[model samples]
Target: MKTQVCIIGGGPSGLMLSQLLHLKGIDTVVLEKRSREYVLSRIRAGVLEHGFAELMREAQCGERMDREGEIHEGFYIAHDGVLDRVDLHKYSGGSSVVVYGQTELTRDLYEARDKMNGVVIHNAEDVTPHDLTSDKPYVTYRKGDEVIRIDCDFVIGADGFHGVSRKSIPRDAITEYEKVYPFGWLGVLSRTKPVSPELIYAKHPRGFALCSLRSQVLSRYYIQVPLTDTVEDWSDDAFWAELKRRLPEEVSARLETGPSIEKSIAPLRSFVAEPMRYGNLFLAGDAAHIVPPTGARGLNSAASDIYYLYHAMVDHYINGSDEGLENYSAKALARVWKAQRFSWWMTTLLHTFPDRIPYDQKLQQTDLEYLFSSEKALGSLAENYVGLPF
Candidate 1:
């Protein structure tokens, strides 16, 4: 098979890029190592920066999102047994975030691809890119003992952190930066109604907890845990009891508890790979960078990457310009580092650091106190939370 672009991932980033490029009459093919069912089964963060929501509309995949997703103008930060709201709309100059599940968003992308009869190969094994430094690059994958090769103008590495995309690049060619936190988040997806109409981020002596909802009927919640903890270590009852202890008494009194539909423990980490381009191969999304879920920058950061790459591809193909492609790495990384800083700051501010010195804990408390006390501080937080411009 031959195409203009070969995207080595069927997640939102790769799928979104393919959809956008195809709309421009750019032929492309997508390869996924997992089945569609497996891809959609992974639970992820739901908060969408307004900019990301707009990209969905541009891709013609926002109808369901706009209809079903909730627009959150503000969220609460609970500390010292009280809840204080951060006015995202007021502080971000009227920008607000969309609360839509990644699963639903991925489904919409899949349906859109189906309508256009886009090519998305699932369960592709041993996918590899070759001749990346050359003008013509091709990707190969094994399917049922047969090797399939796709010749393309460009190869996109959106497969993910553990994916072969980044690993395919030579070690000396790419510089990696990473920081693994000492704790992880134990998240639960329950069918019960959410405790709050808006999301609540709680920081208590016990730990940090977040009360979020996919919809009014479906709730998603998380509590900070030691990295050593596992799903089997906490039953539904134990999880609920521990979560309640972290929340304020008033909020906990009205909180609804139920069996978790899904549960998983994800370790906190921040990572970025420099110069997202390796010859003709460009990286996007988790393949290039990742943030702790504290600020909801994981998928939104990928959206910015897709946005930059989409415009770059269009300029390269339709306008006969290589400027955007040439500057893609620097441009994307500029915004990426900002997100990393924000996520790191938020995580540091709220999470309990087992190894933190007493002075650091006091400083953390003071930081939260200053945030609520100062309008400028709140504005900064709101601006980052709503997302900075692309």
Candidate 2:
């Protein structure tokens, strides 16, 4: 098979890119290692930055999101038993985030792709990209016993962190930066009404806790835990107890409890691979960078990458310009670094480090106190939380 672009990975980023390019009359193909059912089954962050929400609309995949996704104008932050609200709508020039699960977003993108009859091959194995440094590039993968090769002008590595896309780049050419946290987030999804009207991020003397929701009736909550903790170690009752302890009294008083439908622990890490491009192979999303989930920037950052790459492709194909394509790495990394900064700062502010000295704790407390006391500090958090410009 031959195409203008071959996208390795059918996740939201790759699929979204393909759909956008398809609308522009650009021919492309998608390669996925997993079945469609498996991809849709994975649960992920639901918070959508303003720009990403707009991108979904532009992709013609926003009908369901617009109708069902909740719009959050503000979120609460609790420390020292005090709850403070960050007014994102007020501080962000009327911009707000949409709460729509990543799973649902992928479903919408997949539906649109099917309707358009876009080429997306599932269960593709041993995917590899060759001649990426040359003007002409191609991708190959095995499906069952047959080997399929796709010749394309460009290859997009959206296969994520563990995938082969980034690995394909020469080790000496890419500089990697990473910091793995000592703790993890133990989260539980339950079928119960959320305790608060908005999400609450609490930093208690014990640990950090987050109260988020998928819908009014579907509550998703998390609390910081030791890396040694396992899902088997946490029962529904014990998880609820721990969550309530970390939350403010008033907020915890209204909390509803139920059997957890889904439970898991996710480690926190901040990682970035410099120069998100090598030859005709461009990296997007998790394949290029990863942020700790504290700032909810993982998926949003990926959306920014999609924006840059899509415009670059359009410029190259339609306007006959190579500038966008040439500058893709430098431009994408500039924003990626800013996001990394924000996520790292937020993680430091909210999480309790092991062997943390008293002075550090005081500083963390002082920072929260300053944020609540100063409108400027709150504004900065609001602006970054809603998302910076694309």
Candidate 3:
């Protein structure tokens, strides 16, 4: 089989890319290694930057999100036993973020793809791309005992960090930069009302915690933990108790505790791969870069990569211009580094490092105090939190 483009993933990035390309009269095929059920079961970040929302609208997939997602204009930060709010709308030129779960967004994209009769093969095994540098590029995978080959003019690797796409790049051609934090985030999803009207990021002597929500009725919360800790190490009661201990007394007093519907521990890290394109094969989304979720950039950043790639491919095919395609790497990486810097800065500003000495702690406190005291500092945080321009 042959097509204009072969997308090697069925996640939001690949699906959205396929949907956009279809609107441009471009034919594409998508491959997924996991079952559709497994793909939708994974939970992820919910915050959507304004540009992402607009993209969803363009894909004709934003009706559900616009109807159900919450618009958050600001968030709170608890430090030194007090709660302070950062006005995102005030600092972001009236821009606000939408709180829509990644699961729902993926579902919407899937529905849109189905309505358009887009081709997506699931449960593909041993997926691999070949002859990337050659004029002709093809991808192969197995279904049971049969081998299927798809020849295409372009291969898109939206399969994520663990997928074969990024790894397929020759080691010498890729320069990888990564920083793994010594701790992880312990997150819980429950059906209780959130403790605050908006998300609250708390910094205490014990650790850092965030109070967030997927909807008015579905609450999501997290607390920083050591790398050695596991979900089994903390029961529901223990997790609630610890979360309350770190929150401001007033907020804690109003907190409602309940059994967690889901609990997991996620390691935090910042990683980026240079030169997103390698000959006929291109990387997008998690396949190219990953940021810590502190600033809610993990998925939004992926959306930006898609934005650049979709436009680039369109320009090349329709306008007879190769400039966008040639510049995809430099353009995407420029935004990628800015987001990495923001996420790293937020993580350092809010999280307590176990290895920090007394002086370091004092410095952290001073930074927090300065942030709250200076309008300029708060404005900077708000601008980044609402997201930078694409």
Best by TM-score: 1
Query: Candidate 1 lDDT, tens digit per residue, 1-390?
Result: 999999999999999999999899999999999999999999999999999999999999999999999999999999999999999999989999999999999999999999999999999999999999999999999999999999999999999999999998999999999999999999999999999989999998889999999999999999999999999999999999999999989999999999999999999999999989999999999999999999999999999999999999999999999999999999999999999999999999999999889899899999999999999999999999999999
Query: For model 3, how does the per-residue alpha-carbon lDDT over 234-311 read when each residue is reduced to its tens digit?
Result: 999999999999999999999988999999999999999999999988899899998889999999999999999899
User: Which 10 successive residues of model 2 have the least lDDT summed?
Assistant: 371-380
TM-score of each: 0.99, 0.99, 0.99
| Model 3 error, position 284 (Å) | 1.0
| lDDT digits (tens) for residues 1-390 of candidate 2 | 999999999999999999999999999999999999999988899999999999999999999999999999999989888898899999878999999999999999999999999999999999999999999899999988999999999999999999999999999989999999999999999999999878999998788999999999999999999999999999999999999999989999999999999999999989999889999999999999999988999999999999999999999999999999999999999999999999999999999899899999999989988988888888888899998998
Could you say which candidate leads in lDDT? 1
**What range of 10 consecutive residues in model 3 has the weakest lDDT sum?**
378-387
The 10 consecutive residues of candidate 1 with the worst lDDT sum are 197-206
Off by over 4 Å in 1: none
RMSD of each: 0.5, 0.7, 0.8
